[model samples]
Target chain A: MKKLLKYDYQYLKRTSKFIIFPVVIIILAVLSPLTARYLNEILAFSLGDQAGMFNFPDPVVFDSYVEYLSNLSDIYLYVIIFIGVGTFINDKTKGLYPLILSKPINRVKYLLSKYMTLSSLIFVSLMVGMLVFSFYTYYIFGEVDLLNVFLLSLLYFIYVELILAIAMFSAMYFKSYITAVMITFAGYILVSLINVFSFEFLKYMPGMISSNIIQVISNSASTPDVIYNVVVTLVITGLLVVLSITKFKKYDLN
Target chain B: MDAIKTVNLSKSYNNTLVLKQLNLNVKKGEVYGFIGKNGAGKTTTINLILSLILKDSGQVFINEEEIKFSDLAFKKLIGYVPDVPVFPSYMCAKDYLRFTLDIFDLGDSMVNQKTEEILEFVSLPNSTKKISSYSRGMKQRLAIAQALIHDPEIIIMDEPTSALDPIGRNDVMNIIYKLRGSKTIFYSTHILDDVERVCDRIGLLDDGNLIVQDTVDNIQKNFFSNKFYIETKNEPKFVLKKIAKINQVQNAVKENHGIVCYLEENTDENTLLKKLMEMDENIVEFRRVKTSLEDVFIRLTNEKTT
Candidate 1:
């Protein structure tokens, strides 16, 4: 398993994935806070005479956190899903399996390596993004809650991990990148839709993760609910990973 | 011990049986050439043996031990090269080899040495040109190099040279020739010339069935013992007509520069020669024809169809 992880890291490095994810995240990290800080001024400048008619609210440090979290949820997650599915499916698509699988590597370890590597990349990038966003928010808005921002990034990271598991499972199940990406997107939508239901059990589901991130940043989230959602999401993600490995063991690389 | 064995191995696609009851026993330290036409289940059998796909029913044994699906231990003892070898294009030749060695857990002590040695063995440059920049032939050689780096007991190659140019084919064949006695090679190819040159034994697979399997010499001697060829100074067309009338010649056909006759059982060779002499034929060449692997493959496949 350690050996597989070493090679998987090399794969990420060689493919420039190590650079792509963090750079994109950092750019988002910088842009998010800046966008939140200057939207009124930028909009007024663009609108010119028309800008006088509309009322613009004052920007706050919390708006910066919201902007960063929203980007993490929407754009960053989309990038993660797209690239994650490709990483899982490209070995077969590129005809690397017959040689790679013909080695002594275990199928489960082979998969877990990819999952762990990509998960680590996301973890590290989110950490970097969090620090950058917090720094920029403090510089512009005079005060930033580092702990709250940390918790927000942590919750968002957990949510991204769940999405990645879905991507891996879909890649193995469908074996086509386009289909896998679509299925992963559908999974994300299904979870979001489930969050809309007012059922008590649904509060602990993965769909509530996004809204929960907002609540965590705003400091109104129920600690027990967040803990329950994290545990349940992790369990479901683990199950999906197992399913992916199971499907991959029988995958036909013809 | 037989390095690789498959018994009653079978597979199907879309309910259509593509490989049926394939039982192969490739002995240790011998180059076994698996010859078949395109879509004749050659790749399918290799895939099943390597456990890359689920088999319908059968047993594959490596070094006499039975194998199961998702088995990794057996893979450690085997190296496989697909027909079209694809690598991670972002990596250079040495990078791929090092990765392969790392996958086998070959220690860091000799990694650089082994990587260099294998790259040199396959004639690939040790530079940093990514695999995407490699030509087809280079990729094929790199495939062999990776397969050999681990020093497995057997190497299963599925049509490694089917897509190469003449020079590339020769380069790969030479590598196989160099490793002939050192490793058990289960080579699959549609190129009969390569089999004739490199294989000690040959298996002719027709429509997923192992129709014929034996030493290349034995297969030829068994199937074409009665066949002989004669090249005449004449037009040869008239010679064929005359030879076809002879009772001892069961079948005679005009081939390039000659007439190929399949003699009747127990017929004396001199009878056909004496009859040709009586026809005032100027025979420039006349002898028993050494049948090629191509001939045997064609005859076996045709015989099965008929």
Candidate 2:
């Protein structure tokens, strides 16, 4: 297990993807609220004093965080996909698979170490990014709703885990990182975009749960909707993990 | 008991067969050299023994235990070094060795002690560069270190010197010498000279068959020609043909510049010379030479030997 973890750490540290992940998020976190606060000024710089033609209400810290979190669809999703798809597939290309699997250890244990290490890194980045974002948001626009933030963060965590599971399984099964990312992206878009704000029946989806996160942070989401989404996310992630392990057992891994 | 044995082991890819009923034995405390051309099922056979690939038919035994391919428990009995080894690019040599020891479940003190010993054995005890920055030779040495970390009974190497430069090859050859009699090494390579330099017994794998297997000296004696090279003023073909009719003479062949007469084991050279003198008066020179392993390999793989 110790050797496995050491390898896992090596994977997470490779290519400095972890650094890139948090750096991008940190930059986005600070920029989101800054954009919200200086919307008129930013617009004025672009439009050359034509900004005076339009007026709006003052920016709120909560709205800025919402926008920051909303970027989950574009920035965070892409970064995490980059992280997920290459963990194992790239090693296959570089001729490390045979050396590793040739050992006496079980392949599942090795795969789990990769999975857990990546998950932990992603978790740490998200938590640390949230902390920094919270501090900035509070300082710039007074205090944030700590309880609401906690609840919404939980929902987003499940949502991310679901995406991560898809990304990882696709990489393992397809054996191509690019194809894995493409498939995971296609799945994410299909699930997250279909009747996004208008669908009531399919709100139990992991994607739908993420979309409903605004309501959760705003303290307006119903308890049952939250419960159903969380349950479904866990179930889907669980199923994907089991499927991965099953395929791994018989995988040629050549 | 033999340290390694395979009974009628065979494998195929798609509809094409690669290894066909390969029965091999490697005794303990000896270096068994496995020689074959590229794509001659050397790697495939090694893969089967390591249980990295499932075989179509046959059984593999390590230290007399039947191998269960689906489970990797059998791997505990062997250590393997691939032709080109790679490691976690993020780690330096010391850390990588430590990690290897950990994988084999060594305790902390043992890990440290073994790591130090293995690194020292590989002559890279203080290398601080990440594996990614290492040269091919360095990686190969580190590979040797990692393979020895587990102290396995059988050490399987696939062309350990095939990919190294002259200096690197010498380094690895020296390492093999150091391991002589200390471990049972089943090494595969196309470098016949390396085999001759270190291996005690050799198994020639040709077209997936154990074409020839024996001790070095025995194989040479069994497959190679023990022929006298004779030069004469006139054409020696007629005299060689006469010599070929003798009961003690195995066969005779005409070379470009001389006649080569294969003699039976008990036939004396002076006796053959006297018989040749009686057959031909123009004999000018007579000599005998021992054939090399390369000649034997070529003869065994390409044609039936006398």
Residues B217-264 of candidate 2: C-alpha lDDT, one tens digit per residue: 888766655668887777677666676787777777888767887787
For model 1, how does the per-residue alpha-carbon lDDT over B1-306 read when each residue is reduced to its tens digit? 899899999999999999999998999999999989999999999988888888999899999999998778888888888888889888888888888888887868999999888889888889999989899999999999999999998999999998899999999999999998999999999999999999999888889999988999998888867788899888888888899999888888889989999987688688888998999999899889888777778877887899
Q: Candidate 2, B172: how far from true, in Å? A: 1.2
lDDT of 2 by residue, A103-187 (tens): 7778778777777877777777777677777777777778776666666566777777777788768877886667888998987
> How close is every model to the real structure, measured as TM-score?
0.94, 0.89
Model 1 chain B weakest 10-residue run by lDDT? B291-300
- Roughly what TM-score does model 2 have, to 2 decimal places? 0.89
- Runs in model 1 with CA error above 4 Å? A43-55, B230-238, B254-258, B265-286
lDDT of 1 by residue, A119-143 (tens): 9999998898888888888888899
Task: Give the distance in Å from residue B122's predicted Cα in candidate 1 to where it truly belongs.
Answer: 1.9
Against the reference, the lDDT scores of all candidates come to 0.89, 0.79
CAPRI-wise, candidate 2 is medium
